[model samples]
Target: MLVAGSASPAEAGTGQLLVHLRSLLPGLAGALRQVANVILEDPAWASRATIVELAERSGTSPATVTRFCRTLGVAGYTELRVGIATEIGRADQAGWEVGIGADVLPTDPIDRVLRTLLAVDVQAMHETAAALDLSAVDAVADAVVAARRVDFYAAGGSAAVLEDQQLRMYRIGIATWTWADVHNGLTSAALLGPGDVAIALSHSGRTTETVEMLAEARRHGATTVAITNFSTSPIADVADHLLGTSVRETAFRAGAMSARHSQFLVLDLLYLAVAQRTHERSTEAFARTADAVAAHRTPYEPRARGGSARSADPQRGA
Candidate 1:
């Protein structure tokens, strides 16, 4: 939950709303879900519309809208409107604001689709970064750097993110491995001990396989970290450190689109923190790794594209 006075002006309006929406989406139901979806579809109108008007637009009643507002921790329709209006005002002030809840319909042109995709992804990253708890991130990074071994458990799209993180840590000389198969992941989790770190990535935080591995690792006394969209999920309950991403599922890109990007940003943030701690080793690893692959690539050829080209020396190749 966002604190009363924690968010800055830039982050207070739409940013906090996105956070709430992402967090509460999994639990929304019935007419409340419809109401929430309507608000997401058009924030500016939602901000200014009366309760009765919102109800008419959403195909629900004013009482249902009030119930939805209460679910979001707002006093009533009036407070909800105030919050939305605040976001709309702030968004208007910014020249290049993107709506987090915008969608790409099948009827949209290719260019329009591209614009919507880019806008939503960019907004998700911004909101995720804005809502990130840096202190928790620092703690997770410290745990990773100090761990005897690190195991990443993920599946589906999140599994891809896990593999990328594994490669990144390996490049920096940190011992990390990820498993896509649940049996293999569970087997790996079984070997983890008190000094080991187990990180789980799930969008809904309810994936049984991911949750089981995290539980197993926790049972074995490993420090557990969860990266997910919902903070109140089962994984969050078992995790020692929680890193959340605020990315809503759009009509076209529901499974892993914006969420994956947010996950990557979190992983990158953690990786950078770890890299900063062991700078010498990381730099040396980069140098050695670079040299190992340097001979495989063909050197630049001069005048291949009719540009200025004179030198063939490796350092000054065109």
Candidate 2:
């Protein structure tokens, strides 16, 4: 979710949104963890709620809510609410009722590449299934629901994944901070307060900077969540919550491409699970936000061709 990266106009918003959806850490603050928790408890509710209402429910100031909204990359609460509504619609109609299977066999060179894609993803997901800790995931989601602020620290390839988490959290109404800088991470952890949470990501779970930041957040009395591949890593061992991804590594694994994608999938699942539980508060926030948008919208010129008057054809959106 790097602001400078290629994101559609519809996808762009406050700086934090870029990181929220695309990556994880780029020097995020501690205030956003609480917002993440609220959204996680109920995505539909968060998507429908307003910033003022979100603040009231979370018991924070309006300014903090505004900052949280902007950080997640929406124009404001209204745009986020609308997007969340659509997401909820999609969720309610999810294809979970049907048998889900994706199997690809080799046909050509293109087919071979496709199989490679399938093979890698399938292997990783299977590993993820075996490696995941349900209690830890539920705890992380619950912590996101209850926290007053949220901070994410990711280094190496995981930083990009952290940003993606930020985006999904924002859509569901979470305020998250991401840190890519070791120095800035210390600054963030040093500043964390009560009702806040910290998450750290590392495939090896051995990054000195990431662990250092987690330690700092702990010192500041913040809840800690660790997402990593190794269960015995220092961060994971000390974390209150631990979520994992298992990505099979091979000699061809350069640029950390396959592993990063798996990381993203894991992050998405976590963000959505949290959203599923906190639908009520999120809904109230969205309603307030939608009303504000309706009140503030301004008229714009119609899109017409050849300098002629546009036709009043609502059927085709004239």
Candidate 3:
């Protein structure tokens, strides 16, 4: 299994504890899931509750609770407690109000909805940054910069994210292509070779088409990267590098909607890294691309101070 930043439970900071729990929920089941639900439902209570109290609350034995802590990569119940408490304290210090995770009600004020959405999205980015492995990111960036070409595969909402990356890469003169169609993705994957790179995007890391495309690319000798929310997800298994995001679903924003900001955070990091690695080339490409589109923009006139506006010569400058 992939460890967050390769940190052992003891070394893992308390800030990411809640984020990890949320990401791991989909993969958990049975008594383990029960323990997780109880803690998640009221983590402030869990922080102060005794091991026995937690077990009783979850309707599980102490032994099961121990197993749950182990699954979270913590040493024991005490460590888990400290982590939860510290995370809560940090959130409080940040002035995050309680009920930020509440579902958006139809009757809620627009400002309330705005606050809730911004809060969750910002939190997701923070969690993703905290848990992301810099080594993995650098490795993927190097691979992307050196690759002969790159292929991106995604379906549904993830496709929009891939398209954004593809455009950015293209602007920097990278040979990049994105596919939302499974057949086209597979075809591109089949043509990939040792110098090629393939990236698949999936929120749950369980999208069959995305997984298959990455698997196919890997089989064809391409370096495969998976950006997903869960490390244990199937897509992670096939990837040469895994970048996980942390996103919690509210009733109004589920799956890709909740995951978009987190996913964009990861992609933006990778893109910037690649651009930095090829700074001179990237700079020229960016300038060239900008100039190519300059004529398409509407011309503007600058107003003189307390006087008439001066028109810009569209052919010369705008």
Candidate 4:
């Protein structure tokens, strides 16, 4: 069976909790999926209803409900209620600031707009991180480390993320290539075989080009990994491994805005994991690249009056 998201489980926060739960759907089966669907379809019910009532609504037995709660790492039904209620109270206290489903509006104040955009993107990153299957991440890391070459395919906003990954992996001295165009992606994928890795990024998991490229890579015997929002989409069908991100779209905050942020979270994790596998080499490569680039750039200096200057070298971030 495919492993689902969530490192352990989560106050912990039912709104966020529900997001985590939905990510686990790909790994659930039978009545478990039913119970999860019920709670997800109506979180107010999860926060307020009785266990027996939830069971009835889910069309499952009380035993199954209890099992489901346990699977989520809650002690039992009561704890689930407390957790959901805590999240509800937290949401109420946050007022409109949580911004889980709110959209940016032209009429809104600048602070409100900033808060909404930041809140949604921040929540997406946190939730995406929490829902990641570390074991899947590890497997991808292993494949990356062992592969002779890695090719990445992504279109639109996802291509920006792929470019970042390409740069990062290359900095660490790993052989990497990326293509944002369908023809180029397919051409690169055709050259991949047994020891190669092909990673495709698509928020909708239905991108025709990415799906076809991944399929072609698999046909050529490459290990395929898909980073996407939907676990069961056509892209996932062709991928040997699925890395999922949960990003809900608002009117103004579409896939390009928040979904790209979520995908970056996954890519950062994957990149770091690959780096960790080759710690000494990765460290040396980064230092070498930094030194090489530093020679070409002007030294950091405070701006003089009415003059501009570049920022300082990246110190360890706080």
Candidate 5:
């Protein structure tokens, strides 16, 4: 009872694909598009489809239905089912929702940190795969490389990410700056010129202060980039290009855990890529940075040896 080609990829559910059925339905040489519609409309039944069950539903042959699933990126109907379920599983778990259930307590320290890390990692992978636009990423990278200056800013928990990135870019000799305070962030943005770039980091992508800085940066004719979650959010709208991480977070979990992890990963990718592009400058900068740090070092005894030196001796310095 469904028309074909009416659904677009934009409207497709996470697990349920939208197929163009009108083109191949009872036309000059059509067979499977009709079947695809039947499948697309009710992904659950289609997921469990047998060739005969599917053939009867779409008025197509068993072989035709088998061909349809393969045509639509599945190995066969069985894969189509399991794949859809997996996608649905992902959809169900995305976003920030805290559980209020009775505390399930495990006192193992190592297990706790590992579990949290694993959860964040899983979320990061999902968010990245779901939201990453390769073309947009390439465009952002090209713009960063081509820019004369790049400024980045963050606040609250996201500040850690910007601090780390600031160090990395400083090492590679990119003309980069990071601001955690609002005063400096805005000041930095206000000074931007043409061919300059600004990057804003936020997990929720809706921080008023961060967005204001980004807005100001844009006014100065600099291109803006956002590393954030939620594509339809404010940061994504303001950015010239967006990069996202897929960490589903809840309120009760550790603060700043997932967001910090995602931001670091993105910055690392950009840092290494920029380094490769300007290998000579990066190498010199890295060596210079290392030398400067090494020059400031103070030799120190081991903690145990220092403690022994200060041991409470009854005879004072006789």
Candidate 6:
């Protein structure tokens, strides 16, 4: 599988051509980004266009087009075209007729807004799944399972996502802490050792605080992991493992909002993998936690034939 930081686009499979391109867009240099934009702007046309035609359209030389193809990890122009064609075909077969980038106007009806948002979120989830590296996830899971401690770092919406992972890990008896504050996160990271694990969450992978925290952890000899939408971001540089999320952002939704579901999907997979590895302990923890909260919930009561509520306990008769 194409582990975010380690693999090239060719390793990600042709089906993920568009997604890989989009994720790499932010990190590409000027001429290369222009070429990428040309293809992304009209994939169908680009898929069928010749190399010279693409160069002309992108306002770059044929050499630059060849460089763009090489940057994408394809052999040459032909392979790039084939990848785009395959991606387009796959999208068509999946019935993704709705434009995920459609704008939601202020005057639009609630249904239209709903449809646009749904399409964007669902497409993000699908793309994320398509590009995720399961082997990377398993490796991270194994690290977490054996770690002496795990620290999670993030800010804003990503902080909320990391909190969810923190809670899950805690419930399963894993030693985990979450830091939204940069200062505190750096302190925690500095204390981490070779047996520790540090995970940072960011949509763009460029969040300064989160990146710094992960970098600090790595410097302290901890295993570092970065979960983000862009694989080539600064955070990915310091991470020992990079997990990429493919998020489709619209004007109405920011990167963090668009990335929520996809981030959750990746974390859920990691959490489940960890749980599976520690099955006995995880089951025991679940049972203990459930019992601890059982008394806080009210018992369900059924309604009697006479339209009155009846308690299940005969001792507390209705």
The model with the greatest lDDT is 6
- Residue-by-residue lDDT tens digits, candidate 2, 9-50: 254322112213222322234656566556645665776677
TM-score per model over all chains: 0.81, 0.55, 0.92, 0.74, 0.62, 0.93
**Best model number under TM-score:** 6
- Compute the lDDT of residue 243 as modeled in candidate 3: 87
Candidate order (TM-score): 6, 3, 1, 4, 5, 2
lDDT of candidate 4 vs native?
Answer: 0.79
Cα error, residue 190 of model 4, in Å, equals 1.5
What value does the lDDT take at residue 213 in candidate 4? 89
**Candidate 4's error at 46, in angstroms?**
5.2
Give me the runs in candidate 5 sitting further than 4 Å from their true place. 1-84, 88-113, 126-131, 254-256, 298-318
lDDT of 5 by residue, 1-318 (tens): 211212222333334332212212222136766776676466557657677898999898988877775555455666656755555456456642311111224554876656655655655554454444556566666777788889897888787778788778877777888888889999999999789999999877778888889888998999988877544456766787777654544444542455566667677777777777888988998998898899679765344443553354445462
Query: Of the pair 2 and 6, which is ahead by lDDT?
Result: 6
lDDT: worst 10-residue window of model 2: 95-104
* Clash count per candidate: 0, 61, 0, 0, 3, 0
Error of 5 at 1 (Å): 28
lDDT of each: 0.80, 0.64, 0.86, 0.79, 0.65, 0.87
What tens digits encode model 6's per-residue C-alpha lDDT throughout 1-318? 233455565787887888888888888988898898899888999999999899999999899999988788888988898999988787767766465345678888998888777776777788888888878899999999999999999998889999999999999989999999999999999999998999999999889999999999999999999998887788888998988898866777788887898999999999999999999999999999999999999986777665556454567756
Which parts of model 2 are misplaced by more than 4 Å?
1-108, 254-256, 284-318
Off by over 4 Å in 1: 1-15, 29-38, 49-79, 96-100, 304-318
TM-score of 6: 0.93
Clashes of 3: 0
The local lDDT score (0 to 100) that residue 283 gets in candidate 4 is 100
Root-mean-square deviation (CA) per prediction: 4.7, 21.7, 3.4, 7.1, 10.8, 2.7
